[model samples]
Target: MDDESWALSPNARKPLPELIEDKIRALITNGTFRAGDRLPTEPELAQKMAVARSSLRTALQRLQLQGVVEVMRGRGWYVRSTDVAERDEPLRFDRRVSDSDLLEVRIALETTAASLAALRASQGELDDIAKLAKLHQAASVNDKDELLRTDEDFHAAVVRASHNELLDQLYRSLVPQLRSYRRNSYSSAEVHVRSANDHNQVSWFLRRRDEAGARAAMTTHLLGLYNDLAAQTGMPVEERAGLTNYALEDEPSWQQNR
Candidate 1:
């Protein structure tokens, strides 16, 4: 907002408040307003848009309610990296990253990616995802390495099906950390059950083209993983009741369609 050259369009026929909200949403989606980036002060943005501060605040409040941005009292508003509120210390960029932090990033990335994939994936893409899930499900858990590799492949296929190049690149960059988590997760039998059930459910959701269900499946999968990792390290695991409902229904699409 502060001299950032984000001036609102002057010719819009829509309501001023709505126009302001659209502009902000566009800026955030286009990467101009990044996670944790403080917005321009109310006066500055109002001047830039040539709108009253009251209208601007209304637009911002709408964004806030939508979880697109957050307002910090006495400090100002900032864009959220994820749909949920961010931690006081956002994930760091340095190499000293924790496993829990990497899992957080994975949840944020994969959940949205799955939602988009359910809506946009081609039939062939869904086939690829189903094939990968089958491979993971059929693999021998005793061969931990193979099981883990197939699990990673299934997740990679899901990410590819999302068709978001930037998100794909970011997911690829997190491979090392993901591999670390996978290695630890494979040691537990419960983890294998969680992965198989969740991956199968994910593939089923994709075939059904259920965006919300797909996102929920991926979130549940990763949260299960987070729990597995936490238990291994003796940390308290998160409650799982909310996002853990779906499973591979009898004769899921993957099996019926195959």
Candidate 2:
């Protein structure tokens, strides 16, 4: 719970660019800079942050690739969007998710939520869903973290309204892992905006008592997600599969395929 806590490395820490990129990204997401705002001049920023210009430049360049910034002809780099970090998470790079596997995970939860939300959601719960959806549209510093949390809660409210205490309890328990995996897989504003739209639709239909629509909407949304992940097959991992070079005797060859 300590504000200063961080996971320490046992060996050489990650490269300077990666560390700088992470911190800068957190700042951008936290709204230290707004979209279209210019960043500090490279040399001045490097001096102020006590970092090498090379490292800072590398960090800025990485952000540029994610559409987080742009280098103008006469002007320096400017923030393109803060939600870029959501798209830049591990999902795309952490070995592509299989569409089939992703679908199964989604079907297991969202489908059930749809059915339950149609019958049991309270008026107050419906209002809460709307509030969360509105909050998610905000990306300012005070609202950014709340935006993420609210988005998660919007889906969770569906489970609660479903009126199945067991289902609700199960979802509540799995929420953290589900959220982490979902974010880890596709944590970008692109997905975030889509999810917000989906949440609103699901909530709308459920409020209308459109049972089939609610179920169908949630299931369809999840299926589309699975398909998107599937399209990313063969995304490259950073490390090479050279385990054989360090393999101990008696190790099986099957592990080398990675």
Residue lDDT tens for model 1, 155-226: 777887798967865675675456656765687567677788889999999999998889888887887776
lDDT of 2 by residue, 161-251 (tens): 6778556545544443344445554456677678677777877787798876787677666655654554555534332121221245422
Every model's TM-score: 0.55, 0.47
User: How many backbone clashes are present in model 1?
Assistant: 0
User: What stretches of model 1 exceed 4 Å from their correct place?
Assistant: 1-92, 236-258
The total number of steric clashes, by the backbone 3 Å criterion, in model 2 comes to 6
lDDT values for all models:
0.72, 0.61
Best by TM-score: 1
Task: Please list the residue runs of candidate 2 whose C-alpha ends up more than 4 Å from where it truly belongs after superposition.
Answer: 1-103, 139-147, 185-188, 233-258
